[model samples]
Target: DAPVPSGAKGTYALTIEPLTAIPLYASRTLTSSDPSGFTVQTLPNDRGLVSVPSTSEDLSILQK
Candidate 1:
């Protein structure tokens, strides 16, 4: 887990892994239940990595 700064915004990187050892397409889409709290940023190539921008208010409550 990542720590969200108090009253600040931060980003976290998420690594996507395949269930099997098969080659998959590079283009993929990600979604979040709370779009306002978490935003997904996809990277280039099929590295299976994504960036998530999170808000302080959204993460603060998680610690409670």
Candidate 2:
């Protein structure tokens, strides 16, 4: 996960890459359902990236 920059506040994209090549793969964005302080942005422009507020609590990411 990408760390939020100091005094940085706003929506940002995350970068995602595959460890192994897979056929018929599709891309999409993965946003937080309850974004109280921080959230994730998974778009083509920013895959596997997350947006963080200046002041936020500890966060955990769970992949299905």
Candidate 3:
């Protein structure tokens, strides 16, 4: 299975066990409004035409 891209709205299968044991790096901090660590704001939305930055995160396996 391929991992989904960020800023994508949908359901994803998250293996918590694997995540907890590894180092997961997010492009940005999770807002209080969303706590699932899924929702991410790419760009600042204000005007009609906005340039949204395309951001991506990384996941690495770390040693304890």
TM-score: model 1 vs. ground truth:
0.24
- lDDT by residue for model 2 (1-64), tens: 4445455579755344567776334444344446535544432333345555597565554432
Judging by lDDT, tell me the better candidate of 1 and 3.
1
RMSD in angstroms between candidate 1 and the native structure over all alpha carbons? 13.2
| Candidate 3 residue lDDT tens string, 1-64 | 3445558798843222223666543333344545544456333222234355897765553532
lDDT of 1 by residue, 1-64 (tens): 2334345556644466669898644333444555545444435443445566885557767789
Ranking by TM-score: 1, 2, 3
Candidate 1 residue runs with Cα over 4 Å from true position: 1-8, 25-42, 45-64
Q: What ranking emerges by lDDT with the best candidate at the front?
A: 1, 2, 3
The positional error of residue 7 in candidate 1, measured at the CA in angstroms, is 14
Is candidate 1 or 3 superior in TM-score? 1
TM-score pick, better of 2 and 3: 2
**Among these predicted structures, which one has the highest lDDT?**
1
* Stretches > 4 Å off in candidate 2: 1-9, 23-42, 45-64
Superposed on all Cα atoms, the candidates' RMSDs to the truth, in angstroms, are 13.2, 13.7, 17.3
Write the number of the candidate with greater TM-score, choosing between 1 and 2: 1
lDDT (CA) per prediction: 0.51, 0.47, 0.44
Ten-residue region with minimum lDDT total, candidate 2: 39-48
